[model samples]
Target: MHRLLAGFVSANLFFSAATAKAADLSLDAAPMFNWTGLYVGVQGGYQWSKDRSTEFFTPTGAATGFSQDFQPDGGFGGVHVGYNYQFDWLVLGIEGDADFGRASDGFTCCGGIFTFDARKNWEASIRGRIGVTPTDRLLLYVTGGAAFTDLKYSWNSIEPLFPGVNANVFKTGWTVGGGGEVAVTDRVTARLEYRYSDFGTTRFEWIDGSYEQHPRFHTARTGVSLKF
Candidate 1:
């Protein structure tokens, strides 16, 4: 009985020493960034857009030989909110944001008698984000989901040959993009991103004739975020 007790005590001492050594090694390991929190941010960038519209139309709504194309370029800025979960080397999250863009131009097409003005206004999107962390402080990700925006289309008579008409509509579309983010501090991060949005095609009609337009845009943005 005495020998058995002595052996048991020796075994426990060895076990305790092993546990302490393992704990010390764990404490000495490299620290990892915690990305499991809610974040809010603001971003700004440039946007370029292109749209095709019918310039000349047949009296019976048939296609004509002439067409119209317009391209506008400007800057945009906005704010966003998101939540992220990091597991191993992967980070997944969802983010939503909205921006106001300064992109518009006026032109006369078809017969040069009618002038048209197109303005790109407010835009918003909700997207799923998936990324990998090559390092703790940096993330590379791609995002895709639904997008929203509106266009202000206006038409006027430069020579009084046609009546002035205008159309305003809200549009929904699809967007896809990618970005890179870096943690700047314990509670701050910043990112650079690029996205493309397609608003599809639709036709607008007036009292005398009709026209069709297909609109899309590309945006490159930079943002700063605060984590909570």
Candidate 2:
């Protein structure tokens, strides 16, 4: 009887140790959130532009004494796709996005002698991002790259009575920005970002003369993304 009791105690002790080890293994294997792979998202926000016509030139290339400055502010929305590779606390990624909206403004120069109107149709960017994960689920990053946009300008004069002229320009430039992102779920994330773009100076030829313009803009946007 004593032998049987000893055998039963030994079996119970063995199982108890085995169960404790299994629990420890489970805890050690807990899953962690990772920011790697491809993601696609939609974003929307407001953008404001600052543009200036530095000088008006006659067909003979003589500069007019007047200059015009106009600001166009409006809203825009778009979709973005990107791929991220995470290395420990740092992440590197490439993203592309396109947005369309209206940004229009008009101004009169030289006491209503000359009138100028400007409009923007759409804009896009291809950018590289470098970021750090402050926490497993949060990332802060900076981005910069190429930017493209379409702009239309109209000019009219009264005192001189020059014919109205329209110019449509496609501008290519550079952009830089920064933002923060948070993981809402294992497969979803949210972000907010701001960017500034400069399209440089361009010369547009008109009816009897030409003008020089320098265009740049700022954008603020927010988005939600799905990871794959």
Candidate 3:
């Protein structure tokens, strides 16, 4: 009876030790989440722009002593597509997006004798992204690249009986921004971002005088993407 009791105790100890070791290994060898794939998404938000400064010149390239400032704000919607490759906690990617909306400003100058207006029709960008994953499901990133947009400007003077004149032009420059993304599921992610774009100075020529405008703006948006 003593021998039987000793054998039973020894077997129980051996099984318990083996089970504890297995559990430790299971905890230590868990897999990590990876962010590597192609994705497509849609986004929408509001944008506000500042002209920085404006210059009016005659057809002969001489200054026209007419100066004013304008600010335009509105809502926009867009779509984006991109691909990302991951290295442990770091992620690198490339993305492109296009947005369309109405952002315009109208006001009168010269004692209400002259009416001037500006409108932003659409904008797009191709950017590179660098991000870090602080946790398995959260990512923080910054992006920058080339940007393009269309702006239309109109003006008329009632005192001089001048007809309305419009100049539609495209501007190109650079944009930079940052945002955070959350992995809602294995194949879907949601993100919120903000960007500032500067389209330098563009010359819009009219019959009598030309206008030089510096287009710059701030944008805030949210989007959901599906990974493949």
Candidate 4:
């Protein structure tokens, strides 16, 4: 009877020690994540845009058609700011940025020729980022959000060989895009992203009984980022 009692006590102690070791091991294997800081960075790349046109009748009995195409491909650069939150292998954040650049095209209708110059004075966005850590030294992520832009439109045309007519217009619209980022160091990260923005459409009326028309645009960019 004493031998059986000793055997039962030994089994119970073995299980108790095994349970305690498993709990300790679980705590050690868990992941630790944190992201509570402010970061700023700059990016630059190229953009492509599509323009559309429309026509209508005025108060007077006259017919007119105005169309313009803007194909501006150039370099753009800007700064960004936001806060980040980390969860194990996942990272979420919101960011805002602004850039200044120019993309231009031309317009023609009703026996007159006009050039449309679309300048991007500033633009911004708020996006969410999701990423994964394949190892301690590398991270890959995808981000997207709402965007906005400020655009200006201008035109020059001939008026019956008497004089030239010039008109300028301004408008604003919303934009959206997605991209990926890679952490190159503790304080620096690189990004390759594509964005699409639409500034809606606007109308330009001139004193020479004529007007110009335009539509929204889409832009894509890529560059690097520095975090601190």
Candidate 5:
């Protein structure tokens, strides 16, 4: 009976020591993640655009049957500002960015009879952002909202069946896209996102003719941000 009591006491003491060791090695005392802050960043990426145009002139104009489409690819870089609020594993944010570069393409439409040139100097957007953190260091998000850009162009006909026209104007559109981001450091985060912008159609009067453009395009960009 004395031997049995001693064995029970020894077993209890061993278990207590093991539990204490485990407690020291556990992550329960680690710091909780906090991603509530304002951030500013720079981004650079590639964009491919395909824009559609049609005649806005009256039945009396020379362009009785006129249409044009152009596809262009280029690079863009810009800056962005945003705010983020983390709720458990989901994060909500709002951000705005402006990108400037060159996107131009010259093509012949009307069965290669009409020559058209498309040019865009810059673009900007403001969007609502939402994402989920699969891990403490990563975030997957989808963003969308308002987009603005300019469409500048001049198209002339070699045969004069369609008169020459040039226009430079800024238009508003809707954009939507998504991407994944990772926290590279305590105050820095990096991301890659894709967006599709549609400006619908706009009316313009060039020379003696009225015309309209229905434009849309896609963009993919990578950005790095600093949180405050």
Candidate 6:
């Protein structure tokens, strides 16, 4: 009887240890998931802009011609904030960002007889981001939304040799882009993105004629973010 009782106690201890080990393994196999939080971060990079000049003939029939090509490239920096939702390996989020930098292009017409200085002071956008994680460490995504820009334009004529003409044009339009992100840690991510924005068109009227133009911008950015 003593030997039988000792054997039964040993079996019970073995079963208990096995059950605990199984429970620990089950916990470890549970799916890892993240999302549903707010995040804010800063970004900096370069922007390339294409600006065009359009001339409108006056009702009195003033002659207008195409101006010089305008292309400007420079650096930009900004901050952004957003909320995200997660479903399995997919993340969907809405974000808002504002950037300040030097974005400008100039146009000269009629052999430098008429010149215009166009500059964009600041810009902002609200966008939606959708990303899928192919693995635990890599994320691929696309983004698009509405954008706004503040622009200043100045023009001067040589024939008449008149004072410079200046106007402040505020434009609202749409933007779209795509990029990729890599996870450096459980809470940190590095990102590279490209975006294009269209500011529509604005018309400026003068004594001789009217000017109609549209301003477009392209940007490439790199940023680091902290995830909750």
**Stretches of candidate 5 above 4 Å error?**
1-30, 59-63, 109-114, 156-165
**RMSD in angstroms, all models?**
7.3, 4.7, 3.2, 7.4, 4.0, 5.2
Tens digits of per-residue lDDT for model 5 on 49-113?
77766775565755647676768778999999999999999999999999999888877765877
- Locate the minimum summed-lDDT window of 10 residues in model 6: 60-69
Candidate 4, residues 14-66, lDDT tens digits: the string is: 99999999999999886532343567888877766776544445567265554
TM-scores of all predicted structures:
0.83, 0.83, 0.84, 0.67, 0.80, 0.80
Candidate 3 weakest lDDT stretch, 10 residues: 52-61
- Global lDDT scores for all candidate models: 0.87, 0.90, 0.88, 0.62, 0.85, 0.83
Question: Could you tell me which residue pairs clash in candidate 6?
Answer: none
Q: For model 3, what is the error of residue 51's alpha carbon versus the real structure, in angstroms, after optimal superposition?
A: 1.1
Which residue pairs show backbone clashes in model 2?
A: none
Q: Which is the winner by lDDT between candidate 2 and candidate 5?
A: 2
* Candidate closest to the true structure, highest lDDT: 2
Which segments of model 4 are wrong by more than 4 Å?
1-36, 60-66, 108-117, 132-142, 160-170, 208-215
Give the winner by TM-score: 1 or 5.
Answer: 1
Q: Give the Cα error of residue 223 in candidate 3, in Å.
A: 1.0
Candidate 1 overall lDDT versus native: 0.87
Best by TM-score: 3
- Over 4 Å off, model 6: 1-33, 60-63, 158-161
lDDT for each residue of candidate 2 in 95-121, tens digit (9 for 90 to 100): 999998888898887688878888887
**How many backbone clashes are present in model 4?**
1
Give lDDT tens digits, candidate 6, residues 20-74.
9999999999655465467778899999887777776878545466545688768
How many clashing residue pairs appear in each of the predictions shown? 0, 0, 0, 1, 3, 0
| Residue 198, candidate 3: alpha-carbon lDDT | 94
